[model samples]
Target: MDFETVIGLEVHAQMLTDTKIFCSCSTKFGGTPNSHTCPVCLGMPGVLPVLNKKVVEYAMKMALATNCEINKSCEFARKNYFYPDLPKGYQISQYAYPIAEHGYVLLDVNGEQKKIGITRIHMEEDAGKLIHDEHNPVSYVDLNRTGVPLIEIVSEPDMRSPEEAADYLKRLHEILVYLEICDGNMEEGSFRCDANVSIRPRGQKEFGTRTELKNMNSFRNVQRALEYEIKRQQYLVENGGTVVQETRLWDDAQGATNSMRSKEEAHDYRYFPDPDLVPILVDDAWVEKIKADLPELPLAKRERFVNEYQIPAYDAGVLTADKTLALYYEEVVKLCGKPKVASNWLMGDVMRFLNEDKRSIRECPIKTESLAEMIKLIDEGAISGKMAKEVVEDMYKTGKSPQDIIKEKGLVQITDEGELIKTITSIIEANQAQAAEYRSGKEKVFGFFVGQVMKATKGKANPQLVNELLKKMLAG
Candidate 1:
């Protein structure tokens, strides 16, 4: 029987606020284990929590960007759980009333558009990290992240494949970063996802038993985890084993999912509205203020790149994947006025270097202005495309301008008409048979003469000049 995979993601994005959601503690990623803790965040007795206004503003920005309808009034609730990482016996989160709801994210899968429904986006505080000692049987709790502000985005079960889940995740991540609300750093746990995966018969209207997958730290891992989970459930159902509802941890190294515990239903949390914190009333003025300051998001920028810049949709998507990189491409285009050239070099060599070193485009050594200058050099016939690549490498290494590298390395293109004609004549005389065949019916042999001339000039010869001069010389 044919089966279809169902996936829904719950993404937790750490807001870029300077302080925790309900406390005045620093929200920095790395610090001493308990240095950033306080009475408010540590859940000490006789301490009352105060909500951070900035956190709400950031959440509103994301909601508006994702087309979510903001709830003018919402309340916080306590989620009951027992874990060492959660210093507070119960976590403060949204249950009865969330911040936003009824949104959708659009993705393009193989030239076809797909819409993934967003159930809700709510505000919550992150739990602390539990550091387990490898050498001994002891574990430590780091309370620095105890009260970090996070907005959890819950997606409806609209994705039918692992790729669709990954695509939706990336689209969400890109928008969050573009809005500058979250850093979207998966390694540091700023942006993370929990996937709910199940498999059911293709024609069935009902859903199958689902398992929640956690500890997917990267986009690639999210796809891998979902793929593995889907296959495992399908195997069990095919072998006459009943699918169990539970939570699982993705073992990346083992490439499998291990049972963590039985999944908890809604009542397990014993949720209730918090008495200390009142309902938040997000007025129209506040939402409009955030909307006015919003930057152009990825989807809008991608459409502009294709329609205005005349580049391919794929190139536009890649260039706009990261906000910083997209800005860099635009600056280069502004400098050179050649969007296609800038897009090619940025997507080709610039991305290659960034990916190779595991670096962000913001950390790129080559300046956008310098890249524009290099493209200008290519347009002016000062260097060939191949030679410009070498200059770009040197520029990336020393952060030098292309002109300085070319002058220092003596890699100027041989554009002199007289010099190129003399070299082409010499090549024609050396290869008389091929040249004669070119004068006859063997038109394909013309490329041989051009290659010979370029080889003689060591790839510095102006290719257009070489072709024109070679054709004129061989005509006789």
Candidate 2:
């Protein structure tokens, strides 16, 4: 029988807060292990946890951006568990009443828009990391990540394919980054995903035995792991074998999922309200203020770029994919007042340079205004497009303005018609056969004459001027 895949993502995004979720410990990543811990985060006896107000604000911003309903009253609950990484044994998280619920994020998969339902977005604390020795059978636990503020965004099982799930995750990551709540850095474990995947009969209404896959740190891994899991489940069901409902870990190197343990339910965690932390009361004024402060999300900004700036949808989508890139594009457009040109340069040369150097837009060597100035030079016939590309390479290396480099390197285009004619005349005199070929209806040989002129002038002659002079001179 044909089968269908059902997938839902549980994303845990570490909030961009200065302090831990419930304690005054530092929320910074990549510090000496156990250095960022505090008495409360360490679960010391007689220590009471206090909620960080900034975490609430950050979570509210994300919820408002995702169009979720913020609960007026929510409280923290202790999720009892035992792990070396979790010093508290019971993590402080929201159980009965989460901060936001019933939100939806729109995703475009191959030009078809679909809304993925968000079941809940709750605030929680992150567990520490476990570092295992490669050669020895020993494990080390780093508590630095413990108590770090996290927003667990749980999605409904509405995605049917891995592509949809990947798109949903991308959209949600963009939202989190746009809201300034999360950095969305999967490399540093700032943003991670847990995929719950299952396979059922094509037309069945009920879900099959689902397996939870964790340890997906990147978008590609999420897609690959889901693809592997779906096939694995389908094979099991097809051969009259029972698919177990368990938690699995994605072995990225092996490109497969391994059974970790049985999936835990709410009852298994024995969740209870934390008495130390008071119930959060979000008022209308607070929610409204956060909504007002929300930045223009990726979708709205992309649409605006297409409509207002008259750029293509693909260009707008790419420029608005990252918050910094979008800001940089907008700033360059403001300086040059040419949206399409700016988009071309940004999407082509700027992105190329960034990728080659493994740098982000924020770390770009050339400033937005500098790039605008370079484009302005090319627009006013001060330099040829080819020459401008050379100038851009120099600017990338030396961080100099276009004019400064043009003057210092004497890279200005020779636009004088008289000078170009003299060079073309020299080329025609030297290459008589080619000129005869051009006169005998061999129109393609004109390019040879242009190349000769460019070479004679050491490539300083303006290509447009040469083409114009060559066509006029060769017509006779």
Off by over 4 Å in 1: 133-138, 262-267, 422-452
Ten contiguous residues minimizing lDDT sum, candidate 2: 260-269
- Write one digit per residue (lDDT tens) for candidate 2, span 289-366: 988988999999999999989999999999999999999999999999899999999999889999999999988989
lDDT of 1: 0.92
Off by over 4 Å in 2: 132-139, 262-267, 426-442
Compared with the true structure, what per-residue lDDT tens digits does model 1 show for residues 1-476?
A: 79999999999999999999999999987888899999988888889999999999898888888889999999999999888989879999999899999999999988998889999999999999998999999999889998899999999999999999999999999999999999999999999999999999999999999999999999999999999999899899999997898889999999989998654554488899999898999888988898899999999999999999999999999999988899999999999999999999999988898899999999999999999999999999999998999999899889999999999999999999989888877888899999889888799998888778878988889898888887788899
Measured against the true structure, the TM-scores of the candidates, in listed sequence, are 0.94, 0.94
Counting clashing residue pairs in each candidate, in order, gives: 0, 0
Q: What is the Å distance of residue 384 in model 2 from its true position?
A: 1.6
Candidate RMSDs in order: 2.3, 2.3
| Candidate 2 local Cα displacement, residue 144, angstroms | 2.5
